[model samples]
Target: MSKSKSKRVSIPRSEAEMPSHVYSQLNTSFRSQDVEGDTNLPPVIRSKLQDLFAQIEKEFENLYNENLNLHDKIDALNEKLEKENYNPERQQTIFESTDDVIPVKTSKHKLSGSSQKLKTAHKLKAQTSKIVSSFKTPSVVCSVVKELRGHRDGVWDVAVARPGVPLVGTASADHTALIWIMESGKCALRYIGHSGSVNSIRFHPTRDLVLTASGDQTAHVWQAAITPDYNKTGASSDEDIEGGGEGESGCDTDIEGGGGTSTLRTPIAELTGHAGVVSHADWMSGGDLIITASWDRTAGLYDVEKKELVNTLTGHDQEITHVCGHHSQRLIVTSSQDTTFRLWDFREPIHSVSVFQGHTDTVTSAIFTKREEKVISGSDDRTVKVWDLRNMRSPQATIRSDSAINKLAVSNLGIIAIPHDNRQVRLFDLTGQRIARHRQGHQRMVCSVAWADEHSFSSNFFSCGFDRLILGWSIQNIKDL
Candidate 1:
């Protein structure tokens, strides 16, 4: 129509691969830019341009940050390498020249080694101190002096034959007694023929005879030495007259003077008066009189030389267990199962000076201290009570034992040896302080203990229950300087 306005009409390609109108449309859009302001564009194109610009900005920022971090890393690496190559002498020189501070690494080995050596030296010094302390304390050294074994059964008692002689007499439960030579430790003679076990034995004070108490209800006296048979023509009254009427032959005179028969034989004397078992017998300190206790609740004083029962002291109501004479006084103390011990004046029949009490059970054994002013009694109540002779109502000291004390002996040095059912032989000073404990040998219930000397002593302690072995222990003081 109006050759028509000949207006150029452009269409945007929508689906066509090749379209002449697409190029015409881009030229038209550029020429018509004034159609919208320069800032105004299609929504889709504006958004796409904004996203692309944001991505480019982000990439530039990332590159700039990476370059800065690389510079810092290189600088740190170079500083560390410089420090590694630095010389301590150069650093000291720099510090001295400029008064600058320099860091230094300590010599760890030298300092640590010295500290370790100091600790080791301190430990060694402590160990040496402990050893020295132990060495400074008192210690005991013991040795077996002699061993005597001859009884068919356990030996119940042993006594020294004389003050310094190496001879001893032992009574056994085998119904026999033996005389032992301590030096050789051999049985010199066997005194047999007792009807029951021999419970106690003692040597005559000045003679070669031994006295033994047996369960047979009799006490026998025997010559310790063996004897030979001898003719009794001159000694017998009947044969003496037959030889006295005529001149006595030379052979008879030789027999009488030479004593060719048996000088070793001594007359055997049997003391019989108690109605019960004799528990113990002992010679007086003077060695002239003998005292004995019996289960019949009676104690007797006998003139050993005259073979006569001098006095029968009777007051206890139970078995008398022990008896001992005073060392300096004429008093005698006897203990019994009746839970009491009595002090008797042997010089006078009616003198019962004191009666000791406070034991809860049977008094098993008692002994007068060497001073004779005090008495110590061991009881089945597991206690050892010390009583002053002046006042016997209360005990001066009471020592508790782990078990019943079967026997007690005081050494001349004022030490007490106590044997009990616990199998230990304990030694205590007169002050009742425990000084030492010795195993009479492992686990044996030690029943008897005796002291053989003053400061140094030996014990004849026997065990019955487990070990059933008789043992001897020798102990002596180790003084501290």
Candidate 2:
């Protein structure tokens, strides 16, 4: 009786009334001053309390605005679905050819011995065999043949060496650029010269030189040597060479350990003119000049031989994200954080020839098709837009994705590989038809994807991401279509 004398019953509140407890606590804190002898709080304490109340009010306002935005997004998505007449329950795959049609499987045990029946049975068997063969001998859409693991930090970019070189270069957040033997996936050489993370790296179009852009506000051109220098102790496959320090073995300029090939950390040429971090650098078709994009809201064209800045393309209102030289045309495409992509003529770097402005957010990446007739760009708005250079006033097509895209790679076989923030690498045809999608291909955001070579459309490409993994994927044609 004594133990149960004064038990306080607790009642659970409904979902709508859950905030009553919080309101009670706030009321108690404010009413305490009224109950106390000193009804007025100290000026400092009162000011602090007012600031806290203001912060809470601002937070609630932000949450309300966010809810409104989300509701509008949902409505927009519903409108798009209605416009497209998309019916998930009755999804159909459109086939371009009759060869993709296959008959339903049925029991053959109940068939009669009539000649016509036997002929029909033979035809069915042949069709089944052909389909099974196709399944067994499927073309490589994507296969992870190798996993290059040397960078201790996230790899920001990767570049495959020219055909027959069997080498690949990687720019890493660990403040170094590395070369790997493509065949063995071994760290063949390491270039350590940047004071900050290497943002982008590229092999000279036709030379043995590699150009690397760094967050240190500089780009370096390094000499890549394929000769095996066994006399010098090479760095271990997993070791990272310090950018400017001597090795533990007292080697001031070279890495302590060398791989099959050697990459001197001492840069042959340092292109340092940008006031902000350089994000991207690419060589012109002939490798005679280089184009770079920087956070300083400018893109610069530099003479490779003269090692001097030629012209700075200065029209972007925000940071320039990426720069790419056209394969055949003299045009250069530059993507920017201002939600637009600009095409600048290298011959006339002072002005942009055409500006594409449809993306709602930052334009993170852009690339030119093989012949430079079209440009494909990916934006933080989760859309891939194709713009015909001939008509730059409007986009030719818009391909929507579930997540924001980081990079895009176009193959010669009309396949486009887009790595997105959702950790998916999707393949689409030039017409925007989704060919394939590798969901959760990496554990984290995929930063970049590149076709291994011109002949790589048969099923070879490389991808690197924030997961610290470099994966090789092969593309396979759909078999059960």
Candidate 3:
């Protein structure tokens, strides 16, 4: 046991670095005094004790220096933690004094039977569940299926082609948009028409066209071949279609390897009337009209065929951030930075307008459900409110979050995916109950989320972030909720 204890003891630096020496005098003297071993043993032990004192001093010095280094690291970490406190008010403006901030007004009417049931169920489930956020799912754990990394700057938005077409498009601050082949994670086509940051992209509901909104104060409608690799003509051509006048047109006949894509260098239509950056663009259900929300504090309705602005929807006090077309109707909703969102009936050409004021801060994103009976709006105030279209005075239910929401997407299966500034993307049902969390694939603020189709393991929902990566997450089992 004594030998074992000695073996476990650490060697001191002084002993390790001690000068090499041979005790030749002691060897000669000990040889001569072999018969008087007892008499010389005391002298040898005393010499060894003297050597140990020096080593102990050096070891204590090393221990002191190590302690000092540890203290320095602790001080640095504490300083950083104080600077990056969880409360966002310290790092950025909370907009608390924006006196125009309006409280949700009280409505005299009661909720319908379905809404009442939704609110009750959400409240009960939340109360029964633990307060801490858990990442574990009961059946399937969400994971990153693939990481798409081609953008040189932050990716702003992502949209998938209609189900069964393995194509995904992303907008970036590098002044370009890329079409990614989802199966192989390769960039298939590069659209380089926008002169400024491309903020949003969406495919036509039924055409082979893709629309992009840009910070250059314009939105472009470009042709994108539906084939797997965009090799329709089999040769590079400079052929310009009739309406592709604003940008240049060129094509690469042979696709390159190592995640490279052919370039579609032109846009077929340029919708250009906004005074500021066009923030978002989407095609209406009929595919004949396009609506765009812009930082100019107005929404523009454009005729796709004529490539002209038809009417401007007004009434927001700040920049509009997002716009979504109704699933089956001629109506559209526009979310704005003015802490409100407005609904417009395109059937009346912007004459029939109603504003919904519920969020306390900028409304970052808003979209209608599949049935058009409700709208979910996310805001900078860290809350998502579900509003019944028939009653805009108050929200049917509110899903409060700890961080600001950047964007949200409601899937065809009625599941909502909301991406937050805290690098987490959470899924919630329309009733406001959180079903699952996807914390696997992002390292920075997640800016956008999109669904390829219904909730299926084969059909991935995507998210892009300020980390310059797009992560496709598999979350089919979330439907178990």
Off by over 4 Å in 1: 1-146, 225-267, 347-350, 440-443, 454-470, 478-481
| Regions of model 2 farther than 4 Å from truth | 1-140, 228-263, 347-352, 455-459, 477-481
lDDT of 1 by residue, 399-476 (tens): 765456765777656667777554566666565655666643534345555655622235332222223233445565
| Model 3 pairs whose backbones collide | none
Backbone clashes (count) for model 1: 0
Of the two candidates 1 and 2, the one with more favorable TM-score, higher being better, is 2
CA lDDT of each candidate?
Answer: 0.57, 0.67, 0.70
The digit string of per-residue lDDT tens for model 3 on 1-481 reads 3321111112222222211011000111212233344554577775675567668757854754464344335545643443333333421232223323333453434334444655655564455333222212334467788788778777889998775566788998777787877776666677878877788899877766799998888999987764654333111235532212222233222222222355565688889999987888998887889999988899999999899999898899988888998867898999988899888886763368888888888888889888558899998778998888888888987887756787789877678889876567888777776677765577656889998654233537899986789888777565555
Q: What's the ranking of the predictions by lDDT, best on top? A: 3, 2, 1
Candidate 2 accuracy as TM-score: 0.66
CA shift at 202, candidate 1, in angstroms? Answer: 2.1
The residue-by-residue lDDT of candidate 2 on 186-287, one tens digit each, is 565677778777888888777788899988888888776454422232332313333212233323233223323343556768898999878889988888
Worst 10 residues of 2 by lDDT: 18-27
Decreasing TM-score order of the candidates: 3, 2, 1
Worst 10 residues of 3 by lDDT: 18-27
